[model samples]
Structure formats: C-alpha cells, structure tokens
Target: MFKKSVLLYLLLAIGLVLAACGQSDQGSEDKSKEEETTQGNEEEKASEESGSESEEANDKEEDADFVAAYKEGKDELAKAGEGEEVDYQKVIDLYNNQLQPLVAERDGNIDQQISTALEAGKNGEMDGQVVKQIFDKLTQKVFYLTIKHEFQEIDENWGKKEEVNEEIAEAKEYYEVLKETVEKRDAAYETNMVDQIDAGFSEIEKAVENDDNLGFQLGKQVVDKTLMKTFYLAAGAVPNGYATKAAKEAEEDPDKAKVEQAEGWAFYQSISEYITKYAEEDAKIIEKNFNLETDVKELDPEAVNHAFVRGLSKVALHEYEESEEYWGEDKSAITALEGALFIDMIASDIKRMQGEDAYNTLNEQAQTYLDAVKSDEKEKAMEVLEKIEGTLNSIIEKAK
Candidate 1:
C-alpha cells in the first residue's frame, strides 16, 4: 500500500511542472505582441503630424507671395498718381496677369485661413484670430489692387495728371486783392506767382517719380513754405467777402479745395526764398544743379516768423484748446504737425527769436500744458497755465 501511494505523488508533481511552463510562455508571447502594436500606432501618428505641417507651410508661402506682388504693383500706381513717369500700362498688365491670377490660384486660401484659425481655436484654438488674419490680408490685397487698377485707368484716360496749365484761368492771389492792411506784404496780382510757380512744380513732381530726392528738393524749395505763407497772409488780407466765400467753398466743394490748396502751397514755397535768400551762403543749396532764377526779395525773417506764429497760434487755439477731447486718437498726428509748424516758424524767425514770431513758442507751451494735464499733474498744471499767461503777455508786448 505504501509503494503505490509514493508512485501516485510523483506523477502529480510532473503534471504541475508542465502547467507552470505553459503559463510563462503564454505571458511572454502576449507582451511581445502588445509592443509591436504600440510601435505601429506611434509611426502612424508621426506621419500624420508631418503631413499636416507640410500643408500648413505651403499655404503660408502662397499667401506671402500674393501680398508681395500686390505691393510692387501698388507702388507703380502711386508714381502714376503723382504724375505718370512709370509705365502704368505695364503695371495694369502685371496686375491682371500676375497679382489677380496668383491670388485666385492660391486654391481657396480663404478656406485655409479659416481652417488654421479654427484649428488654433479660441482658448488655444478657440478664437477666430487666424481667420481674421487671413481675411484682413485678403482685404488689403483687394484694396491695393483696386486702387492701382483705377490709377492705371486714369493714366490711360488723362495721359498724366497736370499740376498747372498756364493757359487755364486761375483765381487771383487773395493777398494781391487786399494789399493794404497787415503791413509788410507784397503780393499784388490776383494771380499769385503763377509764372514763378509753374516752371518748378511740374519738374518737382517729375523728380519724385524718378526717385530723385535732390531734384525733388530743388523743386520743393521753390514753393513749399514761403509761397504757402505768402498765400496764407494774402488770404488773411483778402476782402472779408471773398475770404469768407473761399473758406465756405473749400468745405462744400473738394474740387475748389484742391486748386486753392495747391496755390497756397506754391506761394508758401516762394516764401522760403525770402528767408533763405538772405542767408546768401544758402544760395548754393538753393541752386544745386538746377538753376532756379528766383528773384527773391529780402524781408525780415522776423516778420515772416511773426506771421506764422500768430496765424498758426489762432489755428491751434481754435482747433485744440483741449486736444484730447477734440482729437484723442490722432493726438500724435497733431503733435507732429505742431512740431513741423514750429520748425517753419523758427527757421523763418532766424536771428530775431525775440522780435520774431514768438507765437510758435507760446503755441508749443500751450500744447505742453495740454500734455501736462493729460499726464495727471494737477499742481504742475496750474504752473503750466501761469507760464502760458506770462508767455502770451510777452508775445503781446513783442507784437506791440
């Protein structure tokens, strides 16, 4: 009985060993299969990402190229607007053949901008920022192309914009019409410096088209500040009835505004000669390469300065007592214009900062006062007001 029991126990031990070996082999095989499957999934994910990235890059390149073409074409159009020195006909051809076609050929770029925007989302792919960028670029391209095409048409029709035609009838200078009051004035012809201006204006426009800065300057110096001031002073002195009529017409009709402003700028340029000619050393600068036979008379730079000071002061006081309230968004533009007016005043003032138009200085001080208030300095604000009062008193004394 004892021998039989031992034999049965040995058989049972062998069967148990076999079962353990089978389980170990099954676990190893299962782990190997799982690793292979994971690797395959990783490679598929990587390929999808790379393909998406490639598509995105291609889209950006296409959009960028379209914008570039639009800009190049538009610059040519500006040259035409100033006066056609460029081959605007060629520009038109390029636009129709190149820019418009290229943009249209971008294969539904609007959809792509939208896709990119949607994919990015607002909270990290949620907002419409991407779509807006694409839309804005397209809008800009459309506008740029439209303006260029219109300008090209103008060139085709008008042949080129003309600045002044001696044959056409022109209104007389306001200064010449009212030479009595506001003393130290010279303009007498109702037709302000036409011959003096006509010769140079067209050339200046031409020089700009050719990218010749010096030539532009030579032409510019002829009528920029001096001639404009002359016209302004002349306009100020015009018979009250005509002056009111001119101002009223300026607001109602843009056509009249264009002509009047051009005439004003022309006289302003002539005025520069009054001050610059007196600085005999500057004659070389005035006569650089282009022989400007401007028979500029000598006037006290101080007188011109005073005129600019008083006139501009009135303009500023009228428009900008509280600048932020009136022109908040464009305050910087106003400040820059003020700086330019100051330069005009001082350059004209020359040696007589005292007797000259001190109005520019006082005007600057007023702007400074406005700036201080904007800065929230109440104590300094009072001081600024007092300084302005003192400056005005001094200005009044100088005028006397």
Candidate 2:
C-alpha cells in the first residue's frame, strides 16, 4: 500500500510540470506575433511620411517655376518699354505670348497649392500653413509685377495723342501745385527756374492740343525735366555746397586765394573758349542737317559729341583744382557736371535733328551763357548756369 501511494504522487507532479511548459510556449508565441505586427505598422507609417514629404517638395518646385516665369515676363516687358522706340506690336506680342501665359500658370499653381492644402486638412494633416506661405510669396510677386506693368503701360502709350493730352493735363496740374509749393518754401527763390518749368508745361499742353506729333515729342522732354526736378526736390537731393572747397579756401589765405582766383578765372576762360568753339561747330552741323560725319580728332566737331567732352573737361578742371592742396575732390560738382552734360547732349542732338533754326537757337543760348561765364562776376556766372539749364531744356523741347 505504501509503494502505490508514492507512485500516484509522482504522476501528479509530472502532469503539473507539463501544464506549466505548455503555458510558457503559448505566451512566447503570442509575444512574437505582437512584435511582428508592430514592426509592420511602423514600416507603413514611415512610407506614408515619405510620400507626404515628396508631395510637399513637388509643390515647392511648381511654385518656384511659376515665380520664375512671372519674373521673366516682367523683365521682358521692362526691356520692351526701354527700347529706343516703343514697338507697340512687340509689347502686345509679349503680353500675349509670354505674360498672359505666365499669369495663367501662376493662377493654376495657386489653385493647386490651395487644393493640396485643403486635401491635406481633410486628411488630418497640418492645415492652411502651406497655403498661407504660398499666398504670401505670390502676393509679393504680384504687387511688384503690377507696379512694373503700370509703368510699362505708360511707356507703351506715350506716343498716343489722347494719352499724351491726358498726361500733359496731369503734368500741368502738378506743375501748378509744385510752383505754389516752391514759393511757400522759399519766397526769395529764383523764379526763373520755376518760370522755365511752367513754360515747359505750357508747351506740352499746346502740342497735345494741336495734335502735333513733333511738338508733342518736344513737349514730353519738358515734362520729363520738370518731373525729374520735382522728384529731386521732393527727395531732398539738393547740393550742399555753393562753390568748391578750393574756392572756399581762397577766402582764408590771401596769397592762396589770389592764386586760386587766377586759376579759377583761367579755368572759366578755357571752358568759355571750348563752349564758343563748340557752339560754332554745332551751328554748322545743324545747318547741314547733321549730315557731316563727326571728326573725333576735332574738339567735339558735332554737337552730339560735346556732352561727354564737356563733362570730362569740367571733371578734369574740378579734380585739378581740388588736387592743388586747396581741397579734396568735390563729388557733388562732378555729379552736377555729368548730369548737365548728359542733358545738354540729349538736347543738342534733338535740336540738331529738328532743323537749322532750332539748332541755331540752342547754340545762341549756350553762347550767351559762355559769354556770361567770361564776365568773371560770381553772381552773373551763377545766374548763367541757371539760364543754361533752362535753355538746354528748351532745346530739348524744340528738338523733340
């Protein structure tokens, strides 16, 4: 009976051990299955993230292409406007062939970005941020292009009589306001300059009213000059010095002053001589209807060539005076001389092209200023500078 009881106990122990082993195996299998399922889910999530990134990258590329196209269109329009002659057909072609297409493409790109953002939002992705960024960039481009387009339109229609008339009227109104403003700023300000600007506005108005193309062209020059002056004044670009530092230095030291005064007189004399000679030559060229080929060896044989020569001469004189231990170089003088010379050249060419009478008138006015410079009177010389400026503007008008 004792042996039988021992055997039964052993059997029970064996059964319990088997049950524990089976439970362990089942738990291990379940843990392995869970790990495999988790890994598969992680891989799917990674693929989805990569796909979103790729879509975002594509959207950026399309947006970049649209911006580039718009910029290119703006540049082409600017180029067309800056041509020597406005080719209306070319402007039209550019708008039709390039600009319109770009506009359409840009619109499409905006729509696509918006649609993508909306779809992403619906899918519980980040919402509206992408659309906002695209809109911000597009708005900047559109604003800049719109301003450029307006200016191009003005340039394209500049030759039209109706457009010119409207421009002239607008200019006249602005001029009146400018005149009143100037008077308010400096009651003693030289009225001559203002009078000259007024005369320019009048000419533009008259030309447009008469429907005279040549006259209108001339009138445009006056309007352009007046506008430039208005812009300069509005921008506070007035010069700081009335005379060169060298001229000022002469006031402190008598000996140096004497020497500089003599040098200044010599410089003025040289400028006067050149002006007189050039004027005579220019008159002849105009009389010949600018048919004579220019001889560069001669001191500006043609009026058209005088601008650069005169500018260089003035710069050289200023540099020389400044280098004589009197003062540092006067950049303002150099800039002023260059600007004047440029205006003079443009005016001279226009006058010469217009006819002999116009050319002669410009030459005569220049001669008057040169003669005034020779007078050696400071006030008179300064006055002549103003007069020369006004006369040059007049020549530009007549030449047009």
Q: Give the candidate number with the greatest lDDT.
A: 1
Q: Each prediction's TM-score against the native?
A: 0.24, 0.24
Candidate 2, residues 212-296, lDDT tens digits: the string is 5444434344444333333222211112111122234534653333322222221221122223333444333322221111111
Each candidate structure's count of clashing pairs: 24, 0
lDDT of each: 0.36, 0.35
lDDT of 2 at 48: 62
**Alpha-carbon RMSD, each predicted model:** 33.5, 35.7
lDDT digits (tens) for residues 163-229 of candidate 1: 1211011111222222232233333423334443444456555754565544443443333333343
Q: Which candidate is the best by TM-score?
A: 2
